[model samples]
Target: MDIVQTQDLRKRYGKVDRVCDLSLHVPEKKVYGFLGPNGAGKTTTLKMILGLIHPSDGGVTLFGQPMDGKNRLSLLRDVGSLIESPSYYGHLTGLENMVVAARMRGLGMAEIDEALGAVRLSEAKDRRVREYSLGMKQRLGLAIAILGRPKLLILDEPTNGLDPAGIQEIRELIISLPIRYGMTVLISSHLLSEIDQMADVVGVINEGQLIFEDKLSALHALSQQALAIRTTDNHAAGELLTAAKVAWQRSEDYLLLNRLRDDNVARLSQILVAKGIGLLRIEERQSSLEDIFLRITGGAVSL
Candidate 1:
C-alpha cells in the first residue's frame, strides 16, 4: 500500500509553477527517494504532501485517505518530519532540548532517551546543543522526529552539508528505520549518489514536475552500455573507424562507440587487425547513474 500519494498536485507562486502537476506513490515501509536538483521544487512538493502549504491544484492522500483541512492534522499525527533544519535552544543540553520538545507534544521522557540512543547521540546526550557538531545536531533532529515512533518520516535534504562520515551515519540510520521501527521514509536530496545508496524506490523531479518514478533497480536499468576500446595505435584506429564510417569518440587512451552488437564488434576487430592496429583492450561500460539522471531531466539540473 502507498503510505502517501499525490495526484497531479501543483503549487504556483505568481505566474510560475513551483511544483507542477506531480504525482507520487510512496509504499509502506520503504525508503522513497524524492530526488531533484536544487530549485527543482522537491521541498515544495514535500510541503504540499504534508499540508504545510496548500496546493494550487490537485491534492494529497495520506494513509489511503484523502487529506483535507478537516483531517490533515490527525492524518499527520503518525508522521514525523524534519524539514530544512531542526529548531532547538542553543543553551540547552541535547537531553534538555529533547525534553522541551517532548513536553510541548505531551510525550514521555523515556521515549526521548530511546530516540537519542537510536540516533547514536546517547553518548553525548548531556552536551550543550550549541557545542554539538553540525552532524550531531542533524542526528539530534532525527532523534526528535522519531520520538513518537511515527509510521512515516519526511526528511528534506537530510544529508545536506554533511561530511562523508556523517552522511554515511544518516544513510545507515535511514536504511534501518523500516526494519527496526516499521517506518516509511520520504527523503529528498539533490545527490543521486546518496539516493542510490539508501533508497528502495526513487521519484525524480525537475523544474517542478515529476520526471521519473520507479524502483531503484529500474532506474539503474535505464543506463545504456557503451563499447570502450583501447588500441595500441589510437590515431590509426581512429583513421580506420573514420574510413568504416562508424561513429566514435576518441579519448586519450580509448575510443568509445555506442551500443555495438556482437557482429559489429567482430567486424570492427577484423578491420582494425587488417590495418595492423593492435587492439589492446575492449570492454563494455555502463553509463553512470549521474549520466542517466542528466539524460532523464534533459540537463535541467546540475548534480
Candidate 2:
C-alpha cells in the first residue's frame, strides 16, 4: 500500500515555483529517496506532504487521508520528520532533550532509551547536546525522530554531518528501520551514491520538477553496456576514436564509452595498433547510478 501519495502537488513562493506539478507514490515499509540539487524544491515538497505548508495547487495524502485541517495532527502522530536540521536546546543533555520530546507525546522512559540505543549513543546520552560533535548531534536528532515509533519517517539529509563510520551506521540503521520495524522511510539528499546504496525506490527532482521516478533496480536496468578502455597514447587514442566514430570520454585512467556501433575492444585495438598506440585494457560492465544521472541530467553538475 502507498503510505504517501501526491498528485500534481505544487507550491510557490511569490513568483518562484518551488515545486511544479509534482506527483509521487511511496510504498509502505519502503525506503524512498528524494534526490535533487539545492533549491530544487525537495524540502518544499516534503513539507507539503507533512502539512507544514499548504499546497498552492493539487493535493497530498498520507495514510490514505487528505493532509489538512483537524486530521493533520492525527495524521502526523504516526509520522516523524527532520527537515534540513534537527534543533535541540544547547544546554540540555541528549537524554534530557529526548525526555522532553517524549513527554510531549506521552512516550515513556523505555522508548527514550531504545531510541538512544538504536543510534548507538546510549553511552553519551548524558552529555550536553552543545558539547557533542556534529555527527553525534545528528544521531541524537535521529534518535528523537524515532522515539514515537512512527510508521512514516521523513529525514532530510540525515547523514549531513556524519563521519564515514557514522554515515555507514546511519545507512544501515535506515535500511533496517523498515525491515525490522515495518516503518516507511522517505529521505532526501543531494548525494546520489548514498541514495543509490540505501533506497529501494528513487525520485529525482530538479528546478522544482521531478525529472525521474522509479524503483531503484528498474532505473539501473535502463542502461546496459559499460565500456572501459585505456591507452598509452591519450592524444593518439582520441584520434583513433574520432576515426572509428565511437562516443567516448577520458576519465582519470580510461576512456568510458556507451552505445557503440561495433565491438569497442576489437575496433579500438585494431585502430590503436594501426596507429602505433598501445591498447592497455578494455573491459565492459554494467552502468552505475551515477552514469544514469549524468546521462539524464546532461551532466548537470550539482550546484
Candidate 3:
C-alpha cells in the first residue's frame, strides 16, 4: 500500500521553477530514497510533502488523506522529520536536548533513553552538543526525530557530512527502522551509492523533474550491460565493428560494445584473429547505480 502519494507536485520561487510536475508514490513500511543532484529541488519537494512549504501547483496525500492547509497540523503529528541541519542548544547536553524535544512533543522522559539507545548515543548522553562530532550531532537529531515514534520519518541528507564509518552507521540505522519500528522512510540524498545500499524504492529527480521512480530492483534491471574489448589494433577493430553494424564506442584503451552476447563475443574474437587484429582482453561490465543516475540525469555527477 502507498503511504504517500503526490500528483503533479510543483514548487516555484519567483521565475525559477524549483520543482515541476512531480508525481511520486511511496509504499508503506519501505525506505524510499529521494535521489537527485544538488539544487535539483529535492529539499523543496520534501518540504512540500511535510507541509513546511506549499506547492505552487498540484497536491500531496499522506496516509490516504489529502495534505492541505486544513489537515496539515493533525497529519504532521504522525510525521517525524530531520531536514538540513539538526537543531540543538549548543550549551545543552545530548540528554538535555532530547529532553527539550520530548517536552515539546509531549513525550515521556523514558523515550529519551530509548531514542538515544537506538542511535547508539546512550554513552554520549552526558556530552555537550558543542563538543559532539558531526556524526554524533546527526545521531542526536535522528534520536529526537524518532522520539515520539511517528509512522513516517522524512530525513533530508541525513548523512551529508559524515565519514565512511559514520555514513555506514546511519545507513544501517535507516535500513533497520522499517523493520524494527514499522516506520515508512523518505530519505533524500545526492549520493547514488548511499541510496543504492539503503533504498527499497528510488525516485530520481533532475532539474526539478522526477525522471525515474520505481523499485530499486527495477532500477538495477534497467542498467545496460556492455563488453569492453582491448585489441592490439583498435583502429582496425573499430572499422570491423562499424562494418558489422555493431553498437560500439571507442574509449581511451578499449572499445565498448552494447550488443555483445556470449556467442557474439566469440564471433568477434574470431573475426579479430582472422583479420590479424590481436585481441588482448575482453570483459563484461554491468552498469552501477551511479552510472544509471549519471545517464538519466545527463551526466550530473555532483554526487
Candidate 4:
C-alpha cells in the first residue's frame, strides 16, 4: 500500500510554478528517492507533503487519509522529518538537545538512547553539539527525527556537504531503517548518484515538472542497448551501413548504432571486409543512467 500519495500537487509563487501537477507514490517499507536538480522545487514539494506549507492547488494524502488544516498534526504523529537542516542549540550537549526534542514529541527519556544508538550518536551524547563535526551534527538531527520510531522518515539531502566517508555512513544508516524499524524513507536529493545508491523507487522532478516516476530499474531501462563501432573508413562505412538499413551516429572516432543483433554484427563485419574496409573496433554499449537523466531533463540541471 502507498504510505504517502500526492495528487496533482502544485505550488505557485507569483508567476512561477515551483512545483506543478506532481503526483507521487511512496510505497510502504521502501526507500523513495525524490530526485531533482537544485531549485527544481524538491524542497517545496516536500514541505507541501509535510503540510508545513500549503500548495496553490492539489492535495496530499498520508496513510490513505487526505491532509488538511484539521488533522495534519495527528496524521503526522507517525511521520518523522528532517527537512533542509535540523535545528539544535549549539551550546547544548547532544543528549540535552535530544531531551528537548523528546519533551516536544512527548516521548520518554529512554527513547533518547534508542534514537541516538540507532544513528550511532550515543557515544557523542556528552559532547557539545557546536564542537561536533558537520557529519555528527547531521546524525544528531537524524537521531531526533527517529526518536519515537515513526513509521515514516523524510529527509532532505541528509548527506549534503558531507565528505565521502560521511555520505557513505549516512547512506548505510538510511538503507538499514526499513528493516531495522520498518520505516518508509523519503529522501530528496539533487545528486543522482546518491539517489542511485540509496533508493529502490525514484521520482524525478526537474524545472518544476514531474519528469519521471518509477522503480529504479525502470529509469535504468529508459536508454536501450546500442553498439559502438569504428572502422578505417568511417566516411565510406557510414554509407555502406546506411545502405544496409543500419541506423548510426558519429561519436568521436566511433559510429554508435542502436543495437545490432549478433547475426547483424556478423553480416556487417563481412560486408566491411568485402568492401576493403579495415574493422578497427566493434562492441556493445549501454547508455548510462546519468546520460538518460540529462537527456530527459534537457540539461536543465545545469541552469
Candidate 5:
C-alpha cells in the first residue's frame, strides 16, 4: 500500500517555480529518499505534504486521505516531522525539553525515554541543550519526532551533523524503524551516500522538477561502470592495457578502466604479466550517486 501519493503536485512563488509538476508514490513500511541539489524544492514539496504550506496547483494524499487545510490535525496526528533544523531552548535540559514536547503531544515520560534511547542519547539525557554538539542536537530533534510514535515520520536531512559512528547509528535506526515498529519514513537529504544505503526507493528533484523516481539500485544500474586500478607501473600498465585492446585512462597514480569486465581483467593481467608490469591492486567501481547527479543535472547543483 502507498503511504503517500502526490499527483502533479506543484508549488510556485510569483512566476518562479520552486517545485514543478511532481508526482510520486511512497509504499507503506518503506524508506523513501527525496533527493535533489540545494534549492531543488525538496523541502518545499515536503512542506506541502505536511500541510504546513499550501500547494499552488496540485495537492497530496497521506495515508489514503486527501491532504488539505481542514484535515491538518487528523493528518498531522499520524505524522511526525523534522524539517531543516530542530529548534530547542538553550537553557532547557534534554529531558526537560522532551518532557515539554511529550506533554504537548499528550504523551508520558516513558515515551520520552523511548525516544531518547532510540537516538542513543540516554546518557546525555540531563545535559543542557546549549552544551550539545551539532550531532547531539540533531539526534535530540529526532528524539522528539519519535516521541509521538506516529505511523509516518518525515525527516529532512536526518543525518546532518553526525560523526561517522553517529551517522551509521542513525542509518541503522532509520532502516529498522519500518521493520521493527511498522513506521513509514520519508527523508530528504543532500547526502546521496546515506540515501543510497538507507532508502528503499528514491525520488530525484532538480531545478524544481521531479526528474526521476525509482528504486536506488534501479537508478544506479542505469549508468555505466568504472574501475579504479592502483598499480606502481602506471606507464607499463597503460601500455599493456592498450596492447591488450583494453581502453583505460590515467588519474594520478591510478588507472581508470571504463566498462571493465571480468574477462577483460583476466586478459589485461596476462598482458601485464608478459610485459613484467608490477601488479598492486584491482577493483571494479560503478558511477557513484554524485556522478549520476552530475550527469543528470549538468553539474549545476552544489554538493
Candidate 6:
C-alpha cells in the first residue's frame, strides 16, 4: 500500500519555486529516503504533505485519503513527525516533555515510557532537557515523536547531532519499525550513507524537482562501474589502453577504465600481460550512494 502519494506537487514562494512538479510515492511498511541537497526543497515538500504549508499547485494523498484542510487533523492522528529540529522546553525534564506531548496527542502515559525505552533514553528520563547532550536530545526528540506509535513516521535529519553509537542505535531502531510495528517511514537526511543503509526506496529531489525515485538497488545499478587497475608499468599500461582506443583515465597510482564487464576485464588483463605490463591488482569499483546522488543532483554536494 502507498502510505503517502503526491501528484505534481508544487510549492512556490514569490518568484522562486521551492518544489516543482514533484510526485512522491511512499510505500507502506518501508523506509522511504527523501534525498536532496541543502535548500533543495525537501523540507518544503514535507511541510506541504503535513499541511503545515499550502502547496501552490498539485495535490497530496496521505493514508489513502486526500490531505485537505478539512481532514488534515483526522489524518495526522495516525502520523508522527519531527521536522527540521525537535522543539522542547529547556527547563522541562525528559519525562515531563513526553508527558506534555502525550497529553496533547491524547496518548496513554504508558506509551511515554515505551517511547523513551525505544530510543534508549529511559535511564535519563529524569534529566532536564537543557542538560542533555546533543545526541541525548536527539533521542529524546525521537522518543516524543514515537510516543503514540503512529502508523506513519516522518523524520527529517533525525540523527543530525548523534555520535557513531547513537547513529547506529537510531538506524537499527528505524530499520526495525516496519517489522516490529508495521509503521511506514519517510525520512530525509543529508547523509547519503545513512540513507543507503536504511532506506528500501529513495526519491532524489533537486532544484525543487524530483530527478529520480525507485528502489535503492535500482538506483545503485544505474551508476557506471569503473575498473581500477594497478600495474607495475603504469606508463606502458596507459600507452596500451590508448592504442586499444579504450576509454580510461590515469590517476597517480592506477588506470581507471569505464569498461567493467567480466569480458572487458579479462581482455584487458590479457592485453596488459601480453605487453609485459605486469598487473598488480585489478578491481571493479561501484559508485557509492553519495556518488550517485551527486551525479543525479548535477554535482550539488550535500551540506
Give the best candidate by TM-score: 4
Please write out the lDDT profile of model 2 over residues 1-303, one tens digit for every residue.
999999999998899889999999999999999988777888899989988899999998899988778788989999988888988998999999999999989999999999999889999989999999988888888899998689999999898867898899999999999987799999999888899899999998888888899999888887767677788988778776777777778878888877555664566578788878887887776766677787776676262
* lDDT, each prediction: 0.92, 0.87, 0.92, 0.92, 0.86, 0.89
Which runs in model 4 stand beyond 4 Å of their true positions? none
Q: Write the per-residue lDDT of candidate 6 for residues 1-303, one digit (tens) a residue.
A: 899999999998899899999999999999999988888898999899999999999999988999888999999999988998888988999999999999998888789988998888989989899999988888888888887789999999888878898899889999988898889999998778888889999998888899999999999888777888999998888988999898789877989988567877888889889888899998887877677777778898483
> What is every candidate's alpha-carbon RMSD to the true fold?
2.5, 3.8, 1.8, 1.3, 4.3, 2.5
Model 4 lDDT tens row, 1-303: 999999999998999999999999999999999988899999999999999899999999999999999999999999999999988999999999999999999988789999999889888899999999999999999999998999999999899889999999899999999989999999999888999999999999998889999999999989768899999999999999899888889999999899877998898899999999999998888878788888899876431
**Candidate 6 structure lDDT:** 0.89
> Candidate 1 clashing pairs?
none
Model 4, residue 142: C-alpha shift (Å): 0.3
- What total of clashing residue pairs does each candidate reach? 0, 0, 0, 0, 0, 0
TM-score against native, each model: 0.90, 0.84, 0.93, 0.97, 0.81, 0.89
Models sorted by TM-score, best on top:
4, 3, 1, 6, 2, 5
lDDT of 3 by residue, 224-244 (tens): 888899999999999999999
Q: Give the residue spans of candidate 2 off by over 4 A.
A: 224-282, 285-287, 301-303
Error of 2 at 111 (Å): 1.0
For lDDT, candidate 2 versus 5, the one ahead is 2
What's the residue-level lDDT of 41 in candidate 4? 94
Model 5 per-residue lDDT tens digits across residues 5-110: 9989989899998988899899999999998787889999999998878889887989999887788788888888999999788799999999999988999988
- Reference-based lDDT, residue 160, model 4: 89
Q: 61, model 4: CA deviation in Å? A: 0.2
Clashes of 4: 0
Candidate 4's C-alpha lDDT? 0.92
